[model samples]
Target: EVTVKGRFLNQRVAPCQLEVRGAAAVWGDDGRLTQWLSTQHAQGTVAPIAAANGVAETQVHILTPDVGGGFGAKIGAYPEELLLGVIAKKVGRAVKWRETRSESMVALGHGRAQLQYITLGGTKAGKVTHYQLWAIQDSGGFADMGTILAPFMTRPMSSGVYAIPNIECRTTSVVTNTTPVVAYRGAGRPEATAAIERAMDLFAFEIGMDPAEVRRINLIPKFLEPHTTVVGQTYDVGDYETALDKALQVAGYTELRAEQAKRRARGDAKQLGIGVSVYVEITGGVGNGESAKVEVLDDGRAVVYTGTSPHGQGHDTAWSMLVQEQTGIPMDKIELVWGDTDLVPIGTGTMGSRSLQQGGNAVFAVAGELVNKAKSVAARILEVSEADVVLDKDRGAFHVVGTPAVTKTWADLAIAEKSTGGLNHNDVINVSGATFPFGAHVAVVEVDTETGKVRHIAHTACDDAGKVLNPLLLEGQIHGGVAQGAAQALLEEVMYDADANPITSNLADYGFISAAELPSVTVVHMETPTPVNLLGAKGIGESGTIGSTPALQSAVVDAVSHLGVRNIEMPCTAERVWQAIQAAR
Candidate 1:
């Protein structure tokens, strides 16, 4: 048996590791190198291969097959995965190399193991006066994205939805012996929200004020146009109070407290808790705009090529909806393709929740151009001026005024144009600008005073990603994001030993939350269309994650507040909770 020892950081304040070994063949080959990758950013992987084998990036063509899941860990190529190409070329055979779940935990990058100290000064009425946050980000050895990610995330969203005038936030990324940290779901935004929300709850506890009341006093007033935060981000548009009130009403906060009071009165084993978080995250900030190509084939079908790569975010269905809305193409007749460098050429692979707002809007823009181009072509064939040609979207045809009989279908126009100018007039159309999405989340948890165990009872989130192109797809994104956020709050953690050795290196020790541990998530949708893009859509991918983490953590602490426990660090495990309760007693 080939033995491997892996270490990882645990959710608790300790380091742990696991060992596993098996008889296996682990090498790279041409077939596996070309087949298994699921990302469009191939430069990182191709560079090392070209150096090892004396070939150019053009020689190494990466094709993404069905990607199971990439949470942000799969954005670039890994060293072991790239070795397949070198080994395959050297042996003149296709090679295969797949890591077990054990290897994946330590080798793959982890996220958000920061030690934060936050202080907030606010009025007795709960309006925030001044806020300060100091973050010691545990970067886990190498500074892979996390170093830059932490500062950028905290700077933009340190104040969340609050209208705080004085905000002081500083972060220092430190190196530790562990897996390198990288972007995961909301990236650094979740950590930022978590810190500030926790601070708000702490301030509420100190001043004997309600957490919700404190939030209300500090939240920015309802506004259109831009509202700049103490940090540098200018919120394009939001109604922070509306989202908070809606979430509170839907959650039935007062009723929940009454139930909690009853449980406390009876000294019941099951305790009740409530937590709330409001956040505004920056999406489509990975530069601005995205590339999209829409083509009307001779058969009258529409083909869309988007620069956004989707692992399971349902880009296919969502982009198809955009094409249908603009070009009157039936959903089944539209084919959406992505993640291939040759087909897409240039693309910022999906991360930072930018796909729908940036990439989807680009698709909408290209589809609109296709409609106008077809109208112009139809006008030429019907012997009418371009202004006289009108597209009947209901009929999916172009008809001249006062001439219903003289109509040309999209298919007819494309076929007829082959003789006049060729397959397509323009190869591609690019769209500009990015959109911001915001949300609020409420979490309820039960804490066992004796055992220090925290259980998530309920979670409700309200997210607005501008105009949702597809409700089904948007809800799925929120579900995944909330689960990840809860996991970070109550279970997931990356740890290191005194000698900088990693522990909790695999799934068994890593504390990744599963369905068995999670409660059914409640999602509320709000639409406040963004004026920045043509589709008026913002990104929904990371909003749930950014808004959920702190809510859950605060709820756990709130559950035992009567016992004199003021602050509790994240991942409130049974042991940590028990210790906090013991110290309080």
Candidate 2:
């Protein structure tokens, strides 16, 4: 068994710790290295194997059998793994190379290297007057993917869910000797949310206004139609204020604040800080559609081939739900297959949360077509008019009106049609369109004035990614997003020395937040169904990241507003918070 594990350190800088302790043997067949890999892009890994073996790219076929999890870190092929194939070929023996967790941290790519200078100008009455964010991103050595990741994440959602018309955001990526930055959970959007949310709290403190009240005044009011931002993308639909109010109500913001005041009066060690952030994230932003092929077999079983790849996003469950809803196919009878390039050659893969909106929609459309085709075949078989026949979904078969006894099961219909032609239709059906998902978040945090230690106390989020297909899967997505966002706010940071040497090189050194550090995230589900897609679903994968980061940061600063503190940089670590408090004092 080849066990490969590596921790990606802050993007490009990966000091790997690998151990190959098994006997190296050779199959002695075709002299090809056949090893299982968990990679996002398979073709990208084949090149090094071919080059190292002194053979053509065709000689090396990198097959991704099963991937545990890859938050854009598994996109490209690594050099060390490629060397295994070469070593196997040179020695005419089988060699195994597996990475350790320590090695994975330094080797895997990190995300969000944005240094932001935010200046918020609002009124004493809690009206947002002006907002400006100037960011300098550390691209981390080679400008891998972070170059584009930073700007797309920082500039697009600069204004967030607010109606701050005088918003100005300028960002530039600077190369540092560290890990090559790539897309993490929320990628660059989380960085933007973090900066602006923290800035909102600073403005609220400067004006001596409640953080919630300040957000209410500035939030973009509920809009029936799409609204364009200063950054140029148009939001399909959102009730920003309603989301905020719902989240606040669910979280008991007023009570939390009352408790915070009590803790401060008694000089309690465990202080309470309430944070609120309003965010609008762009999901399915790539504008590319997903491909799905739904086929009904002779045995009444249905097979669904989807272009949207899923690691643990429950694509099997969610896509099967879509198929069952559209066609009368039962969940058990349907099998969902994906992630194989040969099977799904033409695919955009899964990134930027495009799976459900684009891919799921495709599945729905295909299932509809399959139902129509089945109905036509049933119409021919029963010698009844096509319009007169209707599908009895409860029975999973087509029945004639006023003649329920004369019904044909999908399996019988498929078998009856085999003598005439095939089960599938001749024409190819495809749906090409993209949808947008948006939401708001409220985060509560406590800050120690002396130590500057920021602790997350409570978090509430209201995200509207249109109609939810499955609430269970949706909640999981939100939970994962909240964890990543909270990590960005209170604990996680990819730091480097002055000469570009990475300081946080491993998971032990890097502050990856855990359940012990985070609060029980409160999710207030809101639906502002968009007309853009048939399923009325938008991407919910990144909403938590976009909304939670800002809220948490805002809360941290809001907790210490009475001390005359204006700003605190991301991670809001003990030292940074302490220094900010000292400077204010």
Top-TM-score candidate index = 1
Error of 2 at 543 (Å): 1.6
TM-scores of the models, in the given order?
0.91, 0.87
Residues 108-145, candidate 1: write the lDDT tens digits.
77766777777778676677778887777777678788
lDDT of 2: 0.71
On the 0 to 100 scale, the lDDT of residue 409 in model 2 is 87
Residue 144 displacement in candidate 1 (angstroms): 1.6
RMSD of each: 6.4, 6.8
**TM-score of candidate 2 against the unseen true structure:** 0.87
lDDT of each: 0.75, 0.71
Winning candidate number (lDDT): 1
